[model samples]
Target: MQGSSIAVDKIATELWAAEVIPRVKDAVVYLDDHMAEALHWNRGLAWLLDSGALAVRELSYFESGLSKAEEKAVFIVGEPLVGPCLSRIAAVVRASCFTCCTVITSCPPAAHHSALYGAVPQQELRDSFLHVEEQLLDWMGNMNFSTTVIYAPLALVSVAPNFVIMPQFQDVFPTLPAPQNTNDSCNKELGALPRHLQTSIQSLVGNLCSIMNMLNVKPDVFSLGQTSHFIGEELERCSRSSRKERGLTLVLVDRTMDMAGALTSACDSVMDRVVRVLPPFTKGHSIDVQVDMSSLCAASRSTAESGISNSVAPGCLSHRDSEIAMHHLVTAKQKECLMELNRLLVEWGSRNGLRLDVGGRLTPQLLQKRVNQFRGTSRNVLQGGLLQQVLGVARALSHPGAAKLQDQYGAEKLLLQNAVANGGSPVVQLLRSRHSMGLSLEDVIVLLTLLYSLVGEKALGDDECLLKAEIVQAVYQAAEKDELPLFLHDLLRENVHEENAVLAAVDHMFDVLPGLGSTADTPKHRLLLECSNSGTQPAVYKPLTQQLLHEILQDDPTLQLVHHAGGLTDRIKSGFGFFRAAAKPHPRDNPVIMLFIVGGVTASEAKLAFDVVSSNKINKQVIVGGTALAKPQEQLRLLFQRQFR
Candidate 1:
């Protein structure tokens, strides 16, 4: 935490700027052309408003700079523009007096409804698109305003560096039919992955290949899901080429595979911890949390040279800025976050002509005393920087009870240790005294999952199973009574009244953990899982993606693809291999691994992918994507849907 810097290599940064951002820009470029400005979606709207091509009588609270335009030529750029969004836009436009409006959306009709895209046949999907379009046209035709709708398909949204998500396919898991003959109690069998899901992942892999300019190399696919073999097959089908080298390692994981990791607290990640304490403002694919940027804004105003008093807003941080900060903050370790914040504050104070070197450690009282020394921008020279934004983020992360959450995390760790020592009897004790322990029911559930994972169901007797049932029933009651967290409350509640499903999901994590070499007694694994009290994140809590990549690299550091035995003609006839070549072995320099989670991936997992690629152990890179980027609670709820019903 106190080194030159905590080094992290992010290949997604280059991949996004070079490949993903261009696709996004191209999708919305027509809006720029229409407005005759080289600005993005929101910026283009702002420019049009300034130039009189568009107008908004009322300021929109949700959107930054400008809301959906109520007047002429309102271009809405978003993935999967569904009925609700369209209806809202239509309502707003009808309320206005505009004669004509052009509604340019970033998704087509079929793609607008994600379930329609992922669950139906191609012909049916196309027909549904037509039907939706016809209905939309009719709705607009009857309205007061004449509207022209434009559909521009944008299948992927780059949420963070090296992390992309399909906003339309958030519930990819629930849309697919559960395997037949599987019990409602718990079904963890490998079923045929849905074709639409396969095709979607295939398309994504192709995009990555095309963007990276990979040659005739087949991908080394490692599928880690009950139904992810189809995804690997699809990728392998598309990646058949004449190139002799295995270009990349593509890992397809089902989110259901590791329910324990998803359900647990990501104490290492600052964003995960902060989001748990403070609710984020979620709009479309963007998530923004509250922050106190008042001081930062004040500093900005003091340093503005344009003579405009309102150069910066003084309240909440903007969505764009907040997300950007989140990306960096989420990736940083907790101590790293604190260290960086301290550095930024010291730098800001120095620029503002305040001597704030109080024995090299920044304290709350001393920091406040130094802030009081700033009087009317006396000797303030340098322009305001990211200090305010970072300050806001820091304040939000360290909000009231945030420290207590960390303490609670430690307590949970101790509970797990106690359970491990006493053969998971501590969980039963906690169940009896959960309120006295001050543990949330969610945490209790997570503890049960970890206990089951460490000590198998065989070790957990009838009493433990009943304890699980009691916990699940309590959770159901809390959810019914509207006492559960908002994320849990909104989970797709099917016939998920079975305790066996929860235990099955936890056992599934154990089944996969051994394959990833995490169960082995290697020094690295030992050090990783060892206890730590040095104010650093515990090493045991790695993102599953990172662990999978590590195991893959450990076995074959180069990550070469295993070639098919069939010749080129046979492969072509089978239609599973794309490019089978007889060229010399192509040397892979700094290979890339693409990890795609079928259901959804958490921010912590995505951040860990970045860290693994950036690590010096293996010279490689990773890009992680999923059907949707979700929180731990959201993932747990989704897990319940897949496992039970």
Candidate 2:
């Protein structure tokens, strides 16, 4: 799998350098705090403006910076939100003494205008737009500075937006990309959009096309999964050369295509460990992490093989030393420094005829002496100082409480896997028993939803139905206790009902269709199963879309099958001429396969696409991208908010 972090960072950096930076002088870059964290915007902007020219500040500081500056350029980079701070900043920018100002926003023109004016009627929206434009023009009438507004839409389809600020469930639907030839009204949301939420999605599509054009690679085949017709259509419209070349394949799918994967919490992976331990770590970027020294020390001591005394002086290292230690520990390059420090510590202990322990501490003066000696030579001093800090944090994360939570997650995963693989009364019985897995109500709901997706309503027996009802009631009650919106319970119930209906319809079609029923026993079906879940714990727990891409690319199968859950299957089949015949058998020719998830994709999914190609397989390449990378909790919260709020 490819590391999307690098790709996104590179893209953002390239875009900024090529487009945003050169146009301005003495610019103050105002970054959305959340976007800064999500896209590592600060790092990208800094790298692009290498001459220490970029004054990177939080969006909150825009007004303050405006107040302090005169005849300087101000660049506001963020989503359009009409909060008091943003309104004040907008007003101030119009009146500021900035010579050359630029507003590079992620939001599309329509969404930006809506945020400024608030949602209003069509006539009112125009009036508001004119009013804001007039206000800005009047304010800047006498100013010498030139102002530029750039809508740098981030049409991020393969990856979810911010997990912290999740979209509502209504916003999760696939959005039809606005036609390039369409008028400005195409961007506006004057009435309830008959298709999908165009606000964020339109910008997302536009940005995606921009990125694709920038890269100069045209795809050969575009296989869109169910409900992803809109994105596929947009890609087709934008990338004419890709369609003509017909060498690269692009697959677009929705989140609901693999709902089970999205809802299930991952276990036993580096990514999972990071997600579990580092709550504040957003999008794999290191932030200012708050460490509880006492708790960490206690946890470390308890887990240590030979318990070392905690008699070390509290102020052994100065506050500066502590901060430096933390920086060394968290920074990526310091891994080598840490290793060298470990080797040196072992050597020192051996030379001094002193026993070295994991929890052992040395006096401040001794540690400082060692650090000072290695200050110019090696990073050992800093590493040694931070050893406790790192070890303590790791140990604390491995505490019994965390272990129990993992155990619960594991149990839930096991049950779901078994339910999918071996569907019978036993799984239903287990589901019915509240204490069988010792899982929480939410976990049960997730498992139940997965089961519903796997086994159709017609296939489910009375016992399973009863168990489903019981679980639903339990989840509803639990939500009430937690003060969560009651609609969340209803949403889950609705999801189960929808899944049942869809699966039942699929089953019916298979039964009625002549060749489809028999095809289930073929190797193609087996391949789909392998891609979805390789019948292994790691595969099952990992992102399904990623695992599928990995297997398809690694095995280099002559015939590749792409499965989607929505109505776009026919559209994809029709668009891709190779799969035109509905009853045709798998082709023996080695063909590139594409898989896409529509609603959102996890980080794991994005990684697999990059990883698969890096293997340098001949004619074996997989392209994976998604709308977003949303967490289970975030998705659930969005669903709740969509239904209730």
Question: Which ten contiguous residues of candidate 1 have the minimum total lDDT?
Answer: 32-41
Residue 529 miss distance in model 1 (angstroms): 7.0
Q: Write the per-residue lDDT of candidate 1 for residues 67-185, one digit (tens) a residue.
A: 33332335444433444454555454434443444554444343344434454223223443454445444544554445455543333445555566654556555322233444423
> What's the true lDDT of residue 411 in model 1?
63
Candidate 2 local Cα displacement, residue 309, angstroms:
23
Model 2: residues with Cα > 4 Å off, grouped in runs = 1-9, 23-25, 38-57, 60-73, 78-99, 107-135, 139-145, 153-196, 241-248, 266-268, 282-405, 417-438, 458-596, 606-624, 638-645
- After aligning candidate 1 to the native by TM-score, how far in Å is the CA of 67 from where it should be? 16
Steric collisions counted per model? 4, 29
**lDDT by residue for model 2 (1-645), tens:** 222212332354466556655654556665554345433322344443564444666555335344545455544444554455356556656545554556666654545554544442132123323343444445565434455566554323211111111111224543222234445354233233432243444444445556655544444333333235545554544454343322334555556445555555543222223333434322322222222233222224223332223432221111222343332232212234244444455565454454455333443223333323322323343334354444333433443434655665676556545545555434455545645556555554454444343343322444644654554555445555663333354444444335454344323322222211122223332312423554554223334455445555555454344422223555566567555446432211124444556565544444444545566454543444444444555544443333231
Candidate topping TM-score: 1
